[model samples]
Target: MSARLGPGRTARTVIGVVIGGLFAIPIIAMVEFTLRDGDGHSLAHWAALFDPENARQYAPIWLGLGNSLVLAVVAIGIVLLLLAPTMILITLRFPRLRRAFEFVVLLPISIPAIVLVVGLAPIYLVIGRTFGTGIWSLAFAYGITVLPYAYRAIQGSIDATDVRTLAEAARSLGAGWGAVLTRVLAPNLRPGLLAAALISVAVVLGEFTIASLLGRQNLQTALVVVSKQDTYAAIIVSLLALVFAFVLLVVIRLAGRTQGSAPRTARRAATAPSARAESPSDPSDPSRKGNNT
Candidate 1:
């Protein structure tokens, strides 16, 4: 006889299925629309994605894509370096500060990007006007704006890690704090780091409000440039962004699975041999279960 799922689990499963369909349906429709030809289903849009004329018309597409990638990588790296240590420190040394830190970290979400852009414009204008380099300026903006998402992702990871115990164990083993953090905590926090990095990338790639408001020539700006002239290409750009987001989801899922499975495997490896050694008779082993306990 099959075991029955509990009511709560059944309800959750139903809700999950509904939500999944709600998201998937629109994506499927977009793909269908993008692929449909003027005459019939065709590869024109997909082909146009690689065309030289398309690039010329959408000059910023290439530039914006490159800028976006750079922003994502740098922003994600900065976030991990800054927030990981901060989270660990807060959780380990000053647990009481967590609420305050969280409140401050989450302030970005409460403030509109438009407001942030307006506030930062004067400062960035001076730096850019003086230095004649908006490259680092834009990157810094992207990185700062990504803080809330990145912080939450990493903070959740740090919280789940029981970093205090790990750090103590490492110290007992004569490892320095740096060594402990790099080896023990970072490895365990990989999933959260992956999620945070991808989120930062997604945010940077799709961020139009701040970049446009700041008059920065970024990916979002490029999208806007083409969007006014060619709605079709704009839709294609949107499709490509969706594809990137889907790829990010896959990466996060795989990372989560790898991280989640390690403890189970380690436990089995550590316990199975001990169980065998402790058994006076063979019965406890599955191979000899019929013989004895």
Candidate 2:
């Protein structure tokens, strides 16, 4: 068996390396491009980004980065606090409505960003007045844009999990809705929820047309604006953004895998006592038999 698996494992590892190289090559090229400086390569472009004199020129990028981060947080909030619960409720309570709800949730992805913005133009007029044009208000639009992606992630997880059974079991154990959600449902759904959140963040950060058309600043818009001026600086920022996203995804995966372990441990501990109590112990052993007598 080990011999059979050895070849398969090596094949898989080789495939993985090839795929990783395919992705890493472009990023490596981008890094090399930014390092170019006429006669020689150097970190001058990167270093200039932090230099005091050039600070104001990069201000828009900073502002846009901050806005994008805020939008990511708010968009994740919308997905978790609103979209996720609606999906869970549909799964557990309103199975019949699932198809219609899915259609509504997924409609945005089919529509182009420009068309969505055209439709949103009027609505944002009201929103602008009501919300005073804060960058965070973009979350409302972002929430819609990210819904399709987030929904797929969360729904996949929900489908894999027997959420109905878990909910019912928790309720039978006298857990309230809040308790059940926090203690039972949340732990099980953590993987899907984290994946959905990460997807939403990725979508928000990469977004350009919608933010550009909406006259809002975001990371992509800032990159475009910076690119026209200090091209190398723009590339550096793009490379850093890519690296940051990669790291963020790695950390989130690690967190999703490692978290909720304590609850599993506690559950095991709780069940162990019951198992020992229910089982008859060592009746065949001579010491046990003598003690009983």
Candidate 3:
């Protein structure tokens, strides 16, 4: 078995190394640029970002970062609140509408960002007139952009489980629609909900076109502004953003894995004693003979 597996393992190792190196190259370059200052290595640019005195100078970046963070939270909330219930309702009550719902969710993907921006401009103007152009309003558009991804993640989870039966069962037990959704369906779809939230947050963080065109400052726009003012600082910020996104993805994956494993662990714990009970007693064991006696 070892001999047979050797070549495959070696190939996989080599492939992994190559892929990691490929991803590392740009990051390595960014780090080197950020560290280089006047022929010597320094963290002055990075330090400038956090310097209290420099906060006034970096107002745009600070404001942009703050806006992005707020937008991410709002976007995630909107995505889950909008998609989760709609998806569940469709799955449970309007099964025939699934195809149409999916088509609508996916329509955003085919629409070009520039075109979408143009289409949304008039509505945004009306919104700005009504709500006064708070950057958080961008979350509505971001929510739309992330809708397809969120829908697919939740839909996949719904499809994998018997949501219809669960809802029906909950209803049969005198549970209201609200209770059935919150108490029964939500717990089962935790991983999918988490995945959707993470995906939406990531999308909002990295988004530029909508925020930029809509006259909003977000992380990506802030990075662009910082780039013009201080290239090294921008590079550091970009690298940090990349690292944060990677870490978020890793966390989502780990959470999903843990959620998936819990049931299996419980099943094993429940079955082990039963399996032992069903097994034939060993005649050679004095303890077994005594128990029988």
lDDT of each: 0.69, 0.75, 0.74
Candidate 1 weakest ten by summed lDDT: 284-293
Among residues 3 or more apart in sequence or in different chains, the pairs in candidate 1 whose N, CA or C atoms overlap within 3 Å are none
Model 3, span 26-126: residue lDDT tens: 88999988888789989887888789988887777778889998999998898778789999889888988987787787677667677899988899999
| lDDT score at residue 211, model 2, on the 0-100 scale | 84
Per-residue lDDT tens digits for candidate 1, residues 1-293, read 23454457678799989999898987787778778887788878778868887678767787888877777777877777887788889988999898778667666655677788888889888878788765556777777677666665565456556789989999999999889889988888776777778767777787777677777777778877877977667778788887987787566555655555444322221122122222332232222111000
Q: Which portions of model 2 show Cα errors greater than 4 Å?
A: 1-26, 248-293
TM-score of each: 0.76, 0.77, 0.83
| Rank ordering of all candidates by TM-score, starting from the highest | 3, 2, 1
Error of 1 at 283 (Å): 49
TM-score of 1: 0.76
Q: List the residue pairs that clash in candidate 3.
A: none
TM-score of 2: 0.77
Worst 10 residues of 3 by lDDT: 284-293
